[model samples]
Target: MFPTRAYSRDAEAIVALRDDLARWQVASGIVQWKPGEVTADQVRDQIAEQQWWLLRDDGAISATVRVLEDDPTIWDDLVAPGTGDALYVHGLMVRRTHRGRGLGGVMLEWVESRVRDAGRTTLRLDCAAANTSLRAYYVGLGFTELGEREFPPPYKTLARFEKPVG
Candidate 1:
C-alpha cells in the first residue's frame, strides 16, 4: 500500500502541492482550479482543522484530499450541513505526473475508510458542472450525481455526487 498520513506540521508541502495542482489545472484549461480558487491560508487551515491526508510514494507527494464533516455551502438543500450521513470531500487532486495511475481512487478509498470509522455512511463531493469528464469519472467510480446546484454569488454550477461508504 502507498504511504498515507493526516496533515501535520508541514504547511510548506501543503501549499506547494496546492500551488502545483492549481497552476497545472489553469494551464490545462480546467476552470475548476482557476486563480484564487484556493488560497495558502485555506490550505493551512485545512491542515490545521480538517481531516486532510497526504499520500507519498518514493519520497514524493502523489496526492492530497480533505474530508470535512459536512458541506453546507454546497449540500444544504439535500442534507443538513452538520448532521448528515455523508462526509464531504474537498481538495482531492493527484499530481500532474501521477494522473491515471489510480492514485485518486486510492485516496478516495482512504476517505471511505475514514468516514466509515466515523460512522458516516456516505461520501459526498461536488465538481464543476461543465466538467463532464470529471463527473463521468466519479460516476465510473460508483458515485451517483444528485443534480446541479446553484450558488448565491453566481459561481459556476456544481454537480453533487454521493457514494455509500461502509
Candidate 2:
C-alpha cells in the first residue's frame, strides 16, 4: 500500500518535491520553457498562502500541487466571471520513478477533498492546448473542458477545465 503525508510550508520535503517537479516538467516535455526558474521563495509564498501541498510516500515527496484561492487573470477570458467558488490547481506533478502507478488520480482525489473541506463547490485547472495527452488525463479524472485562450510569449494557448465537487 502507498502511504501519503502532507507537508507544510518551506519544509525540506517540499523543497525536494519542487526540485523533482522541475526535473519532471522538463523531461515530460510538458514544459518547453526553462526549468528550475520557479524559485523556492515563490513556492514558499504559495505554501504560506495555503495554496500548495506536497504529497509523500515512504518518506519521499512523490507529488506536488497548488490550490489557488483566486482564478488566474490569464483564464479570465475563457471561463465565466464569478467562478471563484472553485479552487484552481496548478503545478501538479508526479516523480518520474512513480509514473503510471495511479498516483495522479490519488493526488487529484486529494485535491478534490481539499476543495470540499474548504466548502468550495468546484475544482478548476488548465493545461497547455498543445498537450492533448495531458488534457485527456485531466478529462479522465472527471474534469470537463470549459474553454481555451491564447497567452503571448513563453506559453501559448491554454485549455481550461473544471469539475464540480460536493
Candidate 3:
C-alpha cells in the first residue's frame, strides 16, 4: 500500500507544492491553478478541517488530494447541499518528478476506497472545462462526464465527473 495520511500540519509544504504546480501550469499554458492563489492559511484551515491528505514517496510528499463530504459551492447544481451521497475530490496533484508512475490513479483509488468504506456511493470531481487531457484522464478512470457548470468571473466553466463506488 502507498503511504497515505490525513494532513496534520506543515501547511507551508502543501502551499509550496501548489504554487510550484501553478507556476508550471502558467508556463505550460495550462488553464489551471494560478500562481500564488493558494495561501498557507487556506491550506492550514483545510488541514484543520481534515479535508486534505498527503501521499508520500520515499519519505517525500509526492502527491496530495483533498476530499470533501460535499462541495455545494461547485456541485450544487447537480447535488444538493449536505446530500452526503457522494464524496468530492479536489486538488489531486502529483509532483512533476512523480508524474507518470500512476500516482494520480493511486491517490484517487485510495479516496474511492475511503468513500466506499464510508458508505458513500459516488466519487465526484471537477476540472477546468478547457483541460481536455485531464477530462480524458478522468473519463479513463471510470468517471462519467456529468456536465459543465459555469461559475463567476475569473473562474472558467468547470467540467464535473462522477464515478460510482460500492
Candidate 4:
C-alpha cells in the first residue's frame, strides 16, 4: 500500500498541487476546478478540522483528498434527512507527474477503508457534470450515479456518486 497519513503541515504544498491540477485542467480543456480558488488558509482549516489526508511516495506528497462526515452544500438534497450513513470525499487531486500511476485508486481505497472503520456503509463524492471522463472514471470504480443538481452562479451542475462500503 502507498504510505498514507493525515495532513498535518505544509498547507501550501496541497494548494500548489491543486493549482497545478487546475492549470492542467484548463490547458486540457477540462471544465473542473479553477486556479487560485484554493487557498492555504482553507487547507489549513481543513487540516485543523481533521478532514484532509495525504498519500506520499518516496517521502513526497503524491496526492491528497478531503474526507468529511457531512457536506450539506452538495449532498443535503440527495441524502436522506438526518441519515449519516456515508462519508463524503472532496478535492481529490493527484500530482501531474504522478498521474496514471494508480494513485487515485489507491487513495480512494484508503478512504473506503476509513469509511468502513467509521462504521459507514457508503462513500460519496461529486464532480462537475461537464467532466464526462471523470464521471465515467468514478462509475468504473463502482460508484453509482445518485443524480444531478444545479446550484447558484459560480457553481455549475454537479453529478453526485456513491459506492457501498463493507
Candidate 5:
C-alpha cells in the first residue's frame, strides 16, 4: 500500500497536482477545450469548494481527485442521474510517469473509504463517451454504466457510471 495523506484545501502542493492533472487530460486526449490559464487561483477554488484531494507517496504528491460531497444533483444533468446516498467523483488523474503503477486503484480505494466515512453508500463518476478505453477501465474496476449524456457544444458526450461503496 502507498503512503497517503489528506491535504487541506489551502495546501500549496495541490498546484503541482492540478498541473499534472491538466497535463494528463491533454495527454489522454480527454480535454478538447484547453484553458488558456491554469492559475493557482483556479486550483484554490476547487479546493475551497472542498472537492479536491491530493494523494502522495514518499511525501510527494502523485495524484489528485475531487469528490462532490454536496448535492448530487449539481452534476445530475452533467452525468447519469443517481438516487440515494452517493459521492460524485470529478477530475481523477495521475501523473503521466505514475500511470500503470497501480496508483489509480489505490487512489480509488482511498476514495471509496472517504465516501464510506462520510456516511455515503455509493460512488459515481463519468468519462467522455468517446473514451472507450476509459469506460472499459472503470467497468473493469466494478463500476456499472448507468447512462450517457451530451454536454453542450465542445463537450459532446459523456458516459456515467457508479459503484457501491460497501
Candidate 6:
C-alpha cells in the first residue's frame, strides 16, 4: 500500500523485496541496479515516509514500487520552484516469477487511484535511456515522453515520462 500506511511494520520484508529486485535486475542485465544498490536503511526510510508500496498475494510480497511528489535529481531542470507537483514512480518491480503476468499494469492502476484520490493530474516516471525495451513498455502503457536528462553518476541518462491520471 502506497500512501496508505505511513511505515512498514516489517522492515526485513521490504529490504528483502528490494534486494530481490536488485538481484533480478543484475541477473537479467536489463537495468543498472546491483543487489546492494538500495540499503536496508533506505528501504526502511522509504516505507516510514509512505513512498514505498507492497503488493501481496497469498500472504507473501509479490511486488513493490515507490511513488513520490518530488525528484530533484531527475526533474530539477524541468520543474520550477512551486510547480513541480505530480506523482512520481520509482523502483517498480514484480517478482521475477511474476514479471510476465501483467502485475505492472495492476500497480499502475492502483497508482492512478491514489493520484485521483489526492486530486492530482499526472503520474510520472523515469527509466534508463539505454533501456529501449523498458521505455517502449511504458510508452505502450500510454506514458508520454516529457524529456530526457543526463545524470552525473550511476545513471547516465533517463527518459522522463508522464500520463494523466486524474
Question: What does candidate 3's lDDT look like per residue over 1-166, in tens digits?
Answer: 5635555566888888888998898898888789788888888888898888888767678999988998989988778899888999998889999889998999899999989999989999999998888999999999999899889977889999999998
lDDT of 4 by residue, 1-68 (tens): 65355565768888988888999999999988999987999889988898888888777788888889
**Tens digit per residue, CA lDDT, model 5, 1-166:** 6334344533556666556565666887864324433466666776777777766667677777777764444356544555547787876767667889877787788889987898888888888787787899999999999877776755657788889987
Q: Provide the lDDT at 83 for model 4.
A: 77
Ranking by TM-score: 3, 4, 1, 6, 2, 5
* Residue range with the least summed lDDT across 10 consecutive positions in model 6: 1-10
In model 5, pairs of residues that clash are none
Q: List the residue pairs that clash in candidate 3.
A: none
- TM-scores, one per candidate: 0.88, 0.80, 0.95, 0.94, 0.75, 0.87
Q: TM-score of predicted model 2?
A: 0.80
Per-residue CA lDDT of model 2 for 88-155, tens digit only, reads 88877777788888877877888888789888888888877877888889998899998788888767
Stretches of candidate 4 above 4 Å error? 6-8, 80-82
Per-residue error at 151 for model 1, in Å?
1.3
* 60-118: candidate 6 lDDT, tens digit per residue: 67776788877776787887534545778987878777778888888887888878887
> Backbone collision count in every prediction?
0, 0, 0, 0, 0, 0
What lDDT, from 0 to 1, does candidate 2 have? 0.73
Residue 26 lDDT in candidate 5 = 80
Worst 10 residues of 3 by lDDT: 1-10
Query: Which residue runs does candidate 3 get wrong by more than 4 Å?
Result: 6-8
**Model 6 whole-model lDDT (C-alpha atoms):** 0.76
lDDT at position 35, candidate 6: 71
